[model samples]
Target: MTTSPTAPAYIHVLIVDDHQMVIEGVKTLLQGEADIQVAAQASNGPEALRLLPLYPEISVAILDLNMPQMSGVELSRAIHATYPQIRILALSMFHDYSSVTEVLEAGGSGYLLKNTNKAELCAAIRQVAAGHTFFSQEVGTTLLANLVIPANFDRTRDAHPAELTGREREVLQLIAREYSNSHIAKALFISERTVETHRKNILTKTNSKSVVGLIQYALRYKLIL
Candidate 1:
């Protein structure tokens, strides 16, 4: 018997920002990706909510945190409540820990700075669409420097790299160094599949969604020199 072809994963995204120029810029950046499509665009939070129902294929929403009328935080919560299946990725110029925490707590699946590069932004959207979180490296570092860890917190037992195994830490450090999966696999004498498995495990163990977050945790707790 002949098997049917697998369906392609839909990665429709909605861009919500107050500025048309920002929307246009993001659209231009995303134009090269075949798998990712801009399902809709909105200038404000209310318009975003209105447009969302029309784009049922939108798996992710890229939101600007400083939009007028409805902020990204509020939009994130509304999206989470109304369309819990759609993941929210917050975009902003703010580098403060409070802003990042606010977005995440408001149900954002990932966060990126406005100045993020094209590759990182696209990667972040895909990651969040796949039910994983992502954060820009700069944002991660800022959060690490400003975030307050409780005095009672133990790195070994806490939600950071302290919970990771030695092998996982090695993988994380490689990740921090910007090593690709193939490179990591080759360096560690492991298969690419195994490397990917280690990556996922590290993310879960550290409660981190991206390499940036993992690296920040490592630096914050002195897990690596």
Candidate 2:
């Protein structure tokens, strides 16, 4: 008799924020997700750090940006330095370029606005947990508006345009436009798995570390306006 295939492991998460209400809100939003678990919670950076060692199964950390003792950026940096395996997803009210950039620079894998709905929040957590990046639409817009490519940059010389297939290019364009995988799949009349494959190929061809990098690449190559 053949044994059944093993199920995928749960995506354990750690929620960190100074405000108890915010933590409770996140937990409530995540209650319906069967595959995602709130493995632990902490009110500050130090508490979060202390809890990490205890919960070795935690794969993601949702951090609030403006905590008193240690800011989200600082916590992100510290967590990245020590627990590189734990992907960080920053939650903040501010959609400004500086705040978003700070989280990315500090090694955060995703950024979500505090006002994000349950669907987007869960999607972002899953994306970051899978070693991919996600950002709120407003945050993406802010990044695109502020990120300036060099005036003298040569796309023909610098970008590997020849490496990307036509389908990959299409995916990249939609991605720069902030379309989700499901939306991209629907638009292209392809399965989400196919879209994901194209996404991976696009990132590999462009050497993009995250969505931010992919957007910058698109801008540099004039793939999107």
Candidate 3:
């Protein structure tokens, strides 16, 4: 059976980017779609905050890093705290573990590379709006490879042992050593699907939105180290 595209009752979106060209281009594309509407545009994080409360129907917010006055991560945290319902999608050029981790830690629902195709960008927005986390293939690949955090913060492991179950910890050690899920599962005598399930549980218990965060949590508390 062919499924129909879900039409939002009303889609109010806010685009926060520094370049005029990007803002207009995204607006042109989204506003032309059937039900999605470009409700507002902001050049920087400050403007995004000022505009957000005014546009209550905003289902998704696409944010760009390197904006003046405030970085996207800073703005994302504020919005997440106050407007928990709005899905935050980060569009940025930095693809390394550190950069993606910041957005995830700030509570973004998804992360996309700036070079992501228009179709994938649109799909990511819809995915987040439907409450499923989304990530670019590049981002996801890198996430599984590296995870690092500042030297200070306590991992608060006591608050989240479910993520670091004995089996998960074993898997995480191999992951920290940069082993692929397949390799880890085979070496550990488990199926890849079981490995994936453990990975999912780790993310859930640690409140990690991505594989990188899962690794960071694993490393921080010495589970992987």
Candidate 4:
């Protein structure tokens, strides 16, 4: 008789925020998820850095954008520069495009507003931990609203738009329309994993480094029009 396969291990996470209440709240929300475990909590970037060595199993970090001494952007940059393996998720009250862009540019794997519900927050954490980008519904909409696409934008800088598979096109359009992976997965009747795969493929074919870049490419090529 053969033994059954072992279940996958939980992804350890570190929560970093200046506010003790915020950290506790996030920890509470994450309590019921069997696939996730909170390994530590830090009040600031330096504390987080210090705790990293103590908990080397942490695969994801949920960070607050505003903190004393070192802001979330600074912390994210520092963590990314030193520990490239830890994925970051920025949780902030700000929904502005600039703040979101800064977090992403700072090497955050995902961004979600502080008002996010527990379910969405958990989903975002899992998505980032699994190596995919996640943007809250409002955050994505705000980002698209701030973009200014030129009427005569050229698409010849990259490969032909036709090179994208049909699935990739659908995923790209939904992403431009500000749909999160879970939403796209539901709408397209596919798994969130499949949507993530399509997103990575789309980025590769378009040579886009971020979601903002991908949206610009879509507009230039009329993929969203």
C-alpha TM-score for every candidate: 0.68, 0.70, 0.64, 0.70
Which parts of model 4 are misplaced by more than 4 Å? 1-8, 154-162, 165-212, 215-225
Please provide, for model 4 over 1-225, each residue's C-alpha lDDT reduced to its tens digit, 9 standing for 90 to 100. Answer: 112112236889999999999999999998889899999999999999999999989989999999999999999999987887688999999988789878867778788988888899988877777655678888777766776544544656543564887777777766754456887888788899999999998887776767877764665566763
Q: Write the per-residue lDDT of candidate 1 for residues 21-138, one digit (tens) a residue.
A: 9999999999889889999999999999999888888888999999889889999999987887688888999878878877766767678988988899889887777555577888
* Ranking of predictions according to TM-score: 4, 2, 1, 3
Tens-digit lDDT track of model 3 for 1-225: 111123266667889999999888777666556657788999998888999888899989999977888999999888887887688889898778877878877878778987777688777877777655677888877775674443543567454444356777776655543345776677788889988898777766666666556655554455642
Looking at model 3, residue 33 earns an lDDT score of 61
Give Cα distance to truth, residue 155, candidate 2, Å: 9.2
Prediction 1 global C-alpha lDDT? 0.77
lDDT of 3: 0.73
lDDT accuracy of residue 156 in candidate 3: 74
Evaluated against the true structure, the overall lDDT of model 4 is 0.79
What TM value does model 2 have? 0.70
Q: Candidate 3: misplaced stretches above 4 Å? A: 1-8, 147-212, 215-225
Q: What is the lDDT of every predicted structure here?
A: 0.77, 0.81, 0.73, 0.79
Q: After superposition, how far is residue 10 of candidate 1 from its true place, in Å?
A: 2.4
Clashing pairs in 4: none
Model 1 poorest ten-residue lDDT run: 1-10
Structure candidate 2, residue pairs in collision: none
Candidate 3: worst 10 consecutive residues by lDDT?
1-10
Residue-by-residue lDDT tens digits, candidate 2, 7-126: 236899999999999999999999989999999999999999999999999989999999989999999999988987788999999988888878877878788999999999998888
